[model samples]
Target: MILAAIWACWTSAALGQAVPNHADPSAREILPNPVPVPAIRFLTSADFPPFNFRDETGALVGFNIDLARRICEEVDVPCTVQAWPWEQAADALADNQGDALIAGLALSPENGERFDFSSIYLALPGRFVTQADAARGFDPSALTGARISVRRGSAHEEFLQRYLAHATLAPMDDEIAALEAVKAGEADAYFGDAMRASFWLNDNLACCSFAGEAYFRPELFGKGLAIAVPAGHDTVRHAIDWALVRLKEGGSLDELYLRWFPVGFY
Candidate 1:
């Protein structure tokens, strides 16, 4: 049943969160450093499970951890991670607090005003979490005027704003907080990435059933997520892109996708 619990995670197909004109996001693309650097500082959110999380001893590990280290290997840099809340990542990157972030963040326009983003990686759907009432039928519109929970800086928050206009929102630092918000009845529903919504449902609220199809708005939702760097750090930006291109060519991208998405989804 342990693995069954893990396997029960259900999610929607995908979303488009890519940035246009990524070849020169900031007019300066990075070139790889042939010589390896001794240390590089990286930023990530610890709350997103299977993608990134803290271990029992308080170490960060997950798919993004491995993916980021591989990127560092290709770019000839050593990385040290600083785990912070998801909401703080953009501000930290903008203020030069970290060299890069791998939090699977969307390339929102507001974030673009402050930082530079790389190319698209993976696009997944945003889903709704409802308790499966006979009358409501789990439609996003069914719960209008109800309180909903979302992560403070996610593209899904934008989704809620546009789709569930009648609903009031309660923003939290992480998806887990949003899950708790639903459990505690502070919010009527929880919204986030489909994979994340599945994880939240599994780890906490199994009684609730999810509903609806994937919705995507490329302009508002972003093209997809790529690693984000400070606006001025062109050297690092292009190097990461080059590494991703190689990863795509070398079949590493698909391999990583298979490794992380075993149940399989975009």
Candidate 2:
């Protein structure tokens, strides 16, 4: 549980900086070579756009798709990435139809019992957005009685209640409603998933901009995204993890992140 909680708190460096690798620097200088395999079958869902979704040409394309190919290249193995219905991807993996599942599966206890996981490749962070004018000197720590809009019953709301109890909460029905509250001046700020906020910001919502550093509370938000293999498939899991570290170190992972998330959530 602590590993899960600590992994959740892995935040990226400041904006414009290189993407944080998220691997421990104190980790062994020499990593174990992955057991060789004939080919890797990567299974993903077509629903999660920007991560694993079909493009306009009906071609399977997204960050996960690209990453899977890169992993195969790094490991010197042939690979196939196939998209399935979100509801059935896990079953497909369980039935040995795929070597790995690259969908955005959370590293939960229930999931852990069913599959082996690679190192986290991506983690969602909480962020604050406020009116453009008010964003300049915003201080999340100084908000006493300030109204912050968050989705009702979301982990974000729980974060506010635990660490920013001095601030008044205006819980909304959903992420959009929470953001709308800030744009409409009903709340001083909106605190929620940074990735979602990036899309809204890039959508020409000039009324508000990101403020303050991103918050990474895995305990509240759930452990970040990782590739999953069958429960006993250590070889495939190790290969994925090894390739991920190589990708991060070589800047390929950062490139993919910037390509997909142009607004820079972190």
Candidate 3:
């Protein structure tokens, strides 16, 4: 992890100078670019909603979608977003199926071995979702045997495991399904991030409450959302990072964050 961090830092320093799309070689060239930022096939999980999800039109939409487009625009590359089931999107990408993955993923130790990660785009702490009666009162112990549902492969899955030792985990394919488990009474509680939980609950599960204070798992949740790439693909990672920097500089991210996570939405 230290090696990756240091590597990322070095790459960032070098990319402080703008890299023109026409100046770089393609991923298949004899002299490989460290990152695969140009004209690439990007992978994502549509079920993550508000971050990356399929709209009613069956077109992919949400924060990651917006962010990825901005990335491609910044690099002058056209991209294809293939929305797959959330459960195995990362594994599918790791097997060399796509150029990148950007589904609001938290940095994990396991991910470091197989993929390079971009700098955090957003800081998202995990929160609990429950009946207004349970969550309004903010009791973690009340979660015991509470058929707790969380999206599989999300950071919350690992967070709840180490932290909610007394609770029973009910894994779901996506956040919408997990929250549905709670709304349907099959699960007493669910775990997710505040910004996303608000959007999901309002649009999918209307009755669940945004409960307790948000929790952090420095060991598991890490700092923010990142784009994942093949390990040692530093050139692609650097280009993506530069794109994120552009969004921050251009105020696009600020507008989106304010719109999506308005104060007290949680």
Candidate 4:
């Protein structure tokens, strides 16, 4: 079955849950256009599915691509989006080949030295997926003695160790394996990237579904996803930030989120 059909099968209980909001609602300052650039150039990588990737016809498309266009439209500027190898994207931005990057670039201190980031637009939270029957009444914080499978040495595992210390940790080599442990009843639950798990639940696995609320520990999971401009490019950065806040206030950002993520992660 196609993704849309599969997603349609999701229980209304899950769909009714609130989607997480990243944009600050109070940041409603009217931004004065800083340094009017003729156009905005956006660079992205084509490998990160759902966020940025190529379709069967090989057209550059995905959430990030659409978001870049939206930002330009909101700023009332012409824009162009181009794909590059992940490794080359940062260099391309530094070389002035692009004015901004919409790819899921990690917002690290090291990266902060090289780029100025807009406010976080999305955050990938850690979530627990349990057998469909067991999902009801599931409380992640109370999983004492319950074995929870997670990617070995991942930030998710670290989060488990630090916060959900009551649960027994069953580390696996990769996300699929961790999820398989749960599907096969080797583990009581699986905790990992909510977005990745959502894809598996909607398109691949059917025995399990998300349990409880999404966990957001920015310190452990990194500071979520943001647009990046070369350091000192304050004009571009400010413009992007203004557009993003407007999108959130007008619910355009939420629409894009639901469109890309048919199976809501939160």
Candidate 5:
């Protein structure tokens, strides 16, 4: 429930950082060696669709599921993905009920203290969406005086205040209102989660398009999705991180993204 609430709070409203590529000279050393384990039990939830969910046949499927399988392959270990209620999943991980958690989980200070996290495998960046006709590149000068709609008291609002202080801001109650402001021409653009904006453009409203490159502010959005292992489980954490880097390097991660999100935010 905690994870679900966290996801909902973030998603009901709106809704990549530059990752270090394989070229990073220290990439080899940065990757951790996998620890020997009889089996890797992955705990997740079926509530979060596209990331983690069950199909009509009751099979676990989604980006997170695929990534878990890939992790097992990279580690050369057997893996079992089990769907449980979010609270129980967290508890299970803490109780050693599972070797790792593959849910698309965001990290928080409390959670950070409770569990170790892998390198981000997925990031949700803040983006600007505007009317299709008005879609333009992101340039400070171009949007110098533009009106950008954002949810009041949101990370996006704080980002705009701190970075784009020169632009006029229109605060709205929620993601829908902020987007509607742009659709109605009340605001020059809407700054919010790229996923939500994509959904709006692809379904609810087709009149708007993303205006710029995705913005990655960890404080604003998050560190993205990562594997959550029990506290001090450095081996598992590092193993997941290593596998994730490989996935990113081999283009497997991007392929998975494309498969799930045809209308990608990145």
Candidate 6:
């Protein structure tokens, strides 16, 4: 049932690849050009690993923290990134506790109502993983009749139904179970978040390979990762957006991405 394929092979070595010279169009057109403030306070929850977490030395560190520091440097502003409780971060932002929140926050309308957001700096793209021997390139059309494993009730499942409706889906209770289905040869492939898939491939199962381009539909996967600022703080938002563009252009963004996600998915 599988037909032609689109090959876009990625490897751990690809993690160090240079960032593109240009910024994404979504970021370039995000704001109407605003000036940056001289100083800002950045808030984050340091409990999330790779993105934000406490180090062995008790220093709050990770991708978000490093990016925040780089953004501050790029904007020529004094900034402070402090760890706060995850649940309290939003309310703290609302209460003027900080100028920005850089913890892997998702973009949504409800969040848009209370805060401004920078253009997406990171994404958790969906991908397919197959056994190394059975690994092959894939496209939506190529997936017809293929047994794809997905977590029941997850956006990944919804995405497959909406886009690759021709494929047969094996809905499991959770991501691990779906992945296990592939590992056990019960399913042709597992469709899920690239982040989780990468971790599982590198640190857990060690029996699969990622296939195809990273899939990101904001409606299904969310608007990637962005920083949140208090409402009406266009300057702060714009500054972050500007810094992000510069970071992308200079490869700093990709550097941080490689640091956190050593395994490149896209």
TM-scores for candidates 1 onward, in order: 0.57, 0.90, 0.57, 0.90, 0.82, 0.85
TM-score winner between candidates 2 and 5: 2
User: What residue runs in model 6 are displaced by over 4 Å at the alpha carbon?
Assistant: 1-36
- Scored by lDDT, the top model is 4
List pairs with backbone clashes in candidate 2. none
Clashing pairs in 6: none
Kindly give the stretch of ten consecutive residues in candidate 6 with the minimal lDDT sum. 1-10
TM-score of 6: 0.85
Q: Summarize candidate 3's per-residue lDDT along 46-116 as a digit string, tens digits.
A: 88656788789988888778778877776778888888787788887888777789886557777777888
lDDT of 4 by residue, 73-159 (tens): 888899999999999999999999999998988998888889999877887778999999899999876899999999999999998
> lDDT at 256 for candidate 4?
82
**Per-model tally of clashing residue pairs:** 9, 0, 4, 0, 1, 0
Q: After superposition, how far is residue 113 of candidate 4 from its true place, in Å?
A: 0.7
Which should have the higher lDDT, number 1 or number 3?
3
Candidate 3 Cα RMSD after full superposition onto the native fold (Å): 9.9
The true-versus-predicted C-alpha distance at residue 131 of model 1, in Å, is 16
* lDDT tens digits by residue: candidate 6, 17-124: 322222344555554342448787999998988789998999998888998999888878788998999999999999999999988766777888898887766656
Candidate 2: C-alpha RMSD to true structure equals 3.0
lDDT of 2 at 262: 76
Q: Write the per-residue lDDT of candidate 1 for residues 1-266, one digit (tens) a residue.
A: 32131122333323322111222223223456655434457799999877889889988987788778777776677777888889988788778888889897777777787778766566555666766562155666677788888999788888778767898898999988887777777778877776666655655444564555545455545455678888877667767787776665555655666566543322
Clashing pairs in 1: 15-124, 16-223, 17-222, 17-223, 17-224, 18-222, 18-223, 18-224, 30-238
Cα misplacement distance, residue 76 of candidate 2 (Å): 1.4
